[model samples]
Target: MADRLQGKVAVVTGAGNGIGEGCARLFAAEGAHVIGIDRAGADECCDLLDEGATGALFQRIGDRHGRIDILVNAAAFAVFDWTETLSYADWKATLSGELDIVFLATRAAWPWLKASGSASIINFASANARHALEGSPALAHCAGKGGVMAMTRQLAMEGAPHNIRANSIAPGFIKTQATARHLAADPAFAAQVLRKNMLQRLGEPDDIGWCAVWLASDEARYVTGADIPVDAGATAW
Candidate 1:
């Protein structure tokens, strides 16, 4: 049996860990040539927040790959604090990181995606973008993700004429490397999160990866401008 994404080239940001890593690995496994990008040292457990660095990564991919069949923008930043105590710089940093990276990656990959004949752009949003999770102090982070959804819809409409589809995935509390440290320190918190889910468990990277694969594949050829949630029914509650 041939792979679903054979002969395709995919660019996945935040590919160093968590959901992005899962998407990259799964895309590769499904026969897509994956260009994995993250902030420097992310491949070796370092933070990736440099705009120039991310731009350079995508530029290299465009130069080498010539075409990007799927572009997954999964890079984001958030600081959990109450709105009152959140500093201006912290708020700006979180929103800027997500907005800038998503914009840069999409712009850099535009030509290649256009050339691919049929391209898919997958932007990452959060469940909080719709239903706010209590205690999340970073209101700007929530707002930025909402921006991502709007952007996704607009881009999907704009890209449609070119046979390009833009969509977003709103993930709810998945177990990612970044969140693991916090969850580990507070098992009770983690347990509470799990109990909120209809599945009675938190999500894993593969859960998001599978949704990404479908969205990027021909199977979802007609799907665009939609925010698909892989929240394990967290949104249902």
Candidate 2:
């Protein structure tokens, strides 16, 4: 059987590891020509936050692939601290980096997405944006993701006439390299996080990848401007 994304060209940010890596790999497996970008040193890593980098990637994609069918914004960073204690630099790194990367990538890929007639842009958000996490200095992340949610909706509205769709995924407590770092620091905290989930287990990278696949494929052609939570029902309770 033919693959679902056989002729699609996808750009996935933060594709060096974790959920981003999962999305890139799965998209590739589904027959899409994947361009994985990240800051980390890996096969597909590109520092998307750096000025001009994201645009350059999109330019390269256009020049080489001729079109982009999917753009997944999954690059993010966080500095944990109370609102009063968080530094300006940390906040900027968390919020500005995400916004800059997403904006630049979207703008760069706008024409191709419009041309594709069924293109999709997937932005990554966090469940922390919906519920407060005790003792976690996530104000910047929450604010940034909230902005992503808004941007997703706005883009959906603007792109609808052109057949481009934008949607966001808010993941909770996924077992990614980043989350593993936190889990290593406090096993008890990890346990607490798992317990809060309706499934009573941590999520895998593939969980989010599958959702991205659905959103990017024709299966979800009607879905746009929605924030879908792949949080094991963590938001339910």
Candidate 3:
């Protein structure tokens, strides 16, 4: 969808790497004025987990752009551990990193989104929310993503009247920096994932990026409160 987002103002959090970086670059290529925000390596660096800071950043964006047409909350955090070994602190941290950050950023941008006339919010859920990985410890990951799904739906309902649509994207195992080491080191692990997904391969960041572009563009104006799975059939079976 070339230039599908032309003249749009987009803010992509966690844009320093992985799926966020993919979306920011793709959105810019599609002619959006994209502001890439991350704790590092982006157009803007800020801790989105901090409420005051998140509000201030969005306020500044509103002042500069007058309105925000798109928001991609692609930031997330999780500590992998067996359920029995997962400490309370780790669980809390995961919730703060995954769920709270999205809440804070979206809340800050709500007003500007309403003013955009046609705005879209793309939240990151995970296939983990739908099912557990056979050999992985993802108690916190599942909980956090589940929260994201729930919050996104409510956000969609609230924004519907204002024409500000919200939706979530659940990504499959993509070859991201976070997984590169594991993928290279563990052939058995990689094979297990391949066997489960009907695609028999990993997904790329652009796959999710493309879906986001469609949702952010007028093409998907009717979509909201829906969890779109881009997980290569990880949830289909």
Model 3 over residues 202-232: C-alpha lDDT tens digits?
Answer: 9889999999999999899889999999988
> Model 1, which residues run further than 4 Å from truth?
41-56
The lDDT, on a scale of 0 to 1, for candidate 2 is 0.84
Which model scores highest in TM-score? Answer: 3
Local accuracy of candidate 1 as per-residue lDDT tens digits, 41-159: 24322234555765566667778878789999887777766788888898888787777768877887788899899999999988888877654455877888888999899899889
Q: Give the Å error, residue 4, model 2.
A: 2.1
| lDDT against the true structure, each candidate | 0.83, 0.84, 0.93
> What's the C-alpha lDDT at position 198 in model 3?
92
Task: Give the alpha carbon lDDT tens digit for every residue of 45-105 in model 2.
Answer: 4666665766776777788877789999887777777889899999998787667778877
Global CA lDDT of candidate 1, please? Answer: 0.83
Model 2 stretches with alpha carbons more than 4 Å out:
40-45
- How far off is residue 143 in model 1, in Å? 1.2
Lowest summed lDDT window (length 10), candidate 2: 41-50
Native-to-model Cα distance after best TM-score fit, residue 125 in candidate 3, in Å:
0.7
